[model samples]
Target chain A: MRLSELSKRSGVSTATIKYYLREGLLPPGERITATQADYDEEHLRRLRLVRALVQVGRVPVATAREVLAAVEDESSDQLSRLGTAVGALPHGPTTTGDDAATERAGRTAEEVQRRLGWRIVPGNPAHRMLISSLATLIRLGYPCEVDHLLPYGRAAAGIAEHELALIGEFEAPTTQLEAAVALTVLYEPVLLALRRLAQAEEAGRRFGANRGAGADPAADAEGEG
Target chain B: MRLSELSKRSGVSTATIKYYLREGLLPPGERITATQADYDEEHLRRLRLVRALVQVGRVPVATAREVLAAVEDESSDQLSRLGTAVGALPHGPTTTGDDAATERAGRTAEEVQRRLGWRIVPGNPAHRMLISSLATLIRLGYPCEVDHLLPYGRAAAGIAEHELALIGEFEAPTTQLEAAVALTVLYEPVLLALRRLAQAEEAGRRFGANRGAGADPAADAEGEG
Candidate 1:
């Protein structure tokens, strides 16, 4: 099939298809003539995968490129690379310039891991991202701590794992590629939406003054001091 | 004390405090004279809350303003308004232009809610956001569905509620503010990170790449026909 046909079949526009091709997000189709190229089912699959990563997974283009490269590289040590990638958790507590707060966060991470009985490999990128976000909160004088957040993390992780286990029932896309696309496209939005809902609920609880008292002095002092 | 004292007490910088005041995110302190103003503990508390909303909660400043207004409003309708604001389910999949795909999404959302045994609100802003995101993926030609995502959402909601319940265990201010803060700052990131890990594990289960060969021929035809 030609580029236009591929675009029609994929519901992607010709221009965007060109962009994907130019960015090397899609493999080069066979050059049938000076002005024409033919794409195949494999190209369609690759395009879908790329779309899944960028559109649904919310990954940056460059990062998506790297992920695709990792996926396609047969020579790459998949398990080791995946472990390293997964190991870089980014959701732990961030270090607020205060040594005490930083120490508290470190201790809290350890405590949470121990309590949950999950290895929770340290230095995960997601962990760092979350911690940095918390550090930003602490710097701004909010009482953001890992201990305050640990149970939620543990519970969420447990539920997420359980849900993933049930994905085995999704008999579609038995191949790793299909599974990858399905999981990435389907579950990513669900997770993102859940977070958004949870955030809204939290906001309602916080800014909605009817539910609780004014504030806590000791907690405030502990957070600030 | 004066604004500077309030700043010192709150650990929020003078510039930020001024900005907050200007943005009406914080209220004016008592004017001691034309050139001087005095702030009380209330100011400190409010400042902390503002900091929490912005930093830990990641609420945008404009949205924060609305939330603060809702918080301060003492009308009986305020609670209902809060519920309305937070209780919005995602919009059910639209059917006018893309009826088939949207209908499928609606079915998926319903199935997810049914399986979870919770009233998964449709058309909720978060749900809308997720659906739109999924639509974008479908537009980009990924064979992902809402039902594939239902379990994840259900599980996440369960975990979040469980975590929220645990917040009541803390004493006073910690319980009051920290619970809200923990929900906002921690829940989403933890859930998202865990979901990512689950995806990685699913990818690890090399169930063979041909499993998608005959399943969902309609999806394959629509997507790659």
Candidate 2:
């Protein structure tokens, strides 16, 4: 198929497709003529994955590039690398750059990897992006550690896995490809929305009162003194 | 006691105190001399409040001004207006105009007030900042609702109230004050860290499996056909 056909099918613009190609995000199609190119099913699959990472995941182009590289790497240790990358992100009290922070982040990542025992490629771009984001937050004065956040991350991961396992329960997609589509289009929004609701509820509880009025004057005096 | 003394007592910088005074974030202390000023406990209390709204709550300067105004208002409707301002934040779907965004934010503030039935004053810069952050996220394509988030906000507030209720929770000037410090310094980081963990877990579950496996031929066929 031509660029137009791919654009129409993928619902992504022609300009975007070109950009992806230029950025080495999407592989070049077979040259059919001086001005034409032929794209195959693989191109479409790549396109969808790109959309999932860039759009739904909200990853930046540079980071997305790294992730794509990891995905395509054929080394035997790729999976292990991927796992390390995912684990490296800042979660709780993990600091960035400083020796202590690095050690803490490394130890936590190793621990999580040991628990899961999954072969994942280290240096995954998503992991880097997440870690970078946490680092940025810390620089802006929010102190937290990755280990403290690990439990919640693990729980959320469990939920996501559960949701994926149940995808077969749906009748709309008989094949894995259709299932992937349904999962990407419908489930992504639903999961994100649900998470937002959860956070909002948590925020409310932290700032509001169920314990009754402001501080007593005597108590205030003691505290300030 | 001059401005420098007030700064030392409050643990806020002299420059910051000056900024606060100029911005009308703080009421004037007694001017005993042309160059010397006398600030009492009231000034200290207000400074602490200002810090809470600015640093911990991330309230913008202008909005903080408005909230402070509402806080100082003595009218019967002061509470209601305060509640409106505190709860009001730009939430819901995207809006193009600043006025529209402000109006939408006000509705969210009102919702928070209605739910908690607190006589929260308007013009709180912290409240405005929170609302603006939510709006920015929405604009960035994060699908979240103010109404949905209200529960989370309330939960945080509840926690704050409980912390305040703990007598002898702190050994010092006031347990409420101590609680406020702990809540601001510790709780915010913990909550933010947890949220980040949750998101990471979600991403992991979605992308962890079938990773490194080339597009499943069977799945690809289904998605395209």
Candidate 3:
């Protein structure tokens, strides 16, 4: 297929396709004559994947390139493929808190992990995320209870199972990496959005039309005590 | 307490505190003299919340200001506080897919909600997020199954219950807003990070040393058939 046909088929503009080519996010099509080029089915698939990473995942072009690098490297195992893809995601914001807060946060996360019986490496980014979040909660004096962590962790595991199953359902080993990449980036926003909607509905039931947000500060102070 | 004391106590610099004051995200301290002012516990609390929103939540200053406005609105209900906080979050990237993709995405979300008996309102931001994600997935030819949505929704509901309980545990209605803000923004990243780590581990167990990513495209195609 000609470059025009590739663009037409993929719903991407020729100019943008050219941009991806220059950035090395897309491979060069076979040179037909002088300025014209011919692409194949693989080019279409690659272009679609690039768009998914760039547009859907909001991954930077460079990062998308990096992710694709992992996807194309058949030498790596599935776990390695996923690890590389995840590593390519931008790291979260810097965590800044005092020593006490950091220590408390780390302890809470450790305790949560221990209680859950999931053996996460200390170096997992989730540890950083958990500690950072805990630090903020502690600093703000709204320290989360083990009550929340136990249930939250369990619930997260349930979703993780679904994610794994989804990845498992793909038949072609070749397509699995793409499925993983797409599913990994796509679902969080969906889950988060659902969470927001759920919270809003619950808030409506709890604090709407009567007591504001169900705030009974004296009761809270009692709980704290 | 002086601004210096506030800085030392909160771990925020005086310049940023002044900027918050200038932005009206924080109220001015009591005027003690021409050049210096006295901050009290309230200033300290407000500053801490500002840092959580700005540094931890990564909410933009304008959005943080909007959230603070919501937080300070004593008349609003807990639900209103949550709504305001969510509203203060910048909406996700603008969806740029064509019309068919949008329609299919919306239908997918609507179908999932219907199947799950979740009564999310049409205008919910999550709806937009869901639709947008669905659109991206569909446009990229990685359609998500109701199988995935059914479980993901249920899991999110479990976490939502915990969130509501956490919010409920707070006695002061005023603090509920802050709690909502913290939990609302904090947990998603935590959840996402957990999902990644879990996917990696699960991928390791399922496909790491064995067949690659369990991808058997013929089997998948058969299942589809």
Task: Please report the candidate that would top TM-score against the real structure.
Answer: 3
What ranges in model 2 sit over 4 Å off? A9-11, A40-59, A76-225, B1-13, B25-32, B36-60, B63-192, B195-225
User: Can you rank all candidates by DockQ, best first?
Assistant: 3, 1, 2
Evaluation by DockQ, superior candidate among 1 and 3:
3
- Evaluate residue B174 in candidate 2 and report its C-alpha lDDT on the 0 to 100 scale: 34
In model 3, the runs with Cα more than 4 Å from the true position are: A31-34, A94-98, A144-146, A209-225, B94-98, B209-225
Q: Per-residue lDDT tens digits of candidate 3, residues A171-215?
A: 777577877887777777777877776677566656664653555
Cα-based lDDT at residue B95, candidate 3: 62
- Angstrom error at residue A65, model 2: 1.8
Best by DockQ: 3
A1-225: candidate 2 lDDT, tens digit per residue: 999999877767999999999998799999999989999876876776667566644656876676565545556242343433333322323335754434454454444433433323345433433344344333332333444444434544454444344434434322322233223332333333223332333333333334325733233213210
The model with the greater lDDT, 1 or 3, is 3
Q: For residues B1-225, what per-residue lDDT tens digits would candidate 2 score against the true structure?
A: 678887866667999999999999888888898877888876776676677567655677886677566555546242243334443322222222474445565566545544544433344434444455444433322223545444444444444343333412434433233233323433343333333333334344444456635543233213211
Residue range B1-225, candidate 1, lDDT tens digits = 898888777778899999999999888888889978898866776777677667655677886776666545556344344444333322223222455555555565555544544344565666565556556545555445545565556556655565555544545532343334434443454445545543443334333235434554233223221
Comparing 2 and 3 on DockQ, the stronger one: 3
Listed per candidate, the RMSD to the true structure in angstroms reads 11.7, 13.1, 8.5
After best superposition, candidate 2 residue B105: deviation in angstroms? 20
Report how far residue B86 has shifted in candidate 1, in Å.
4.3
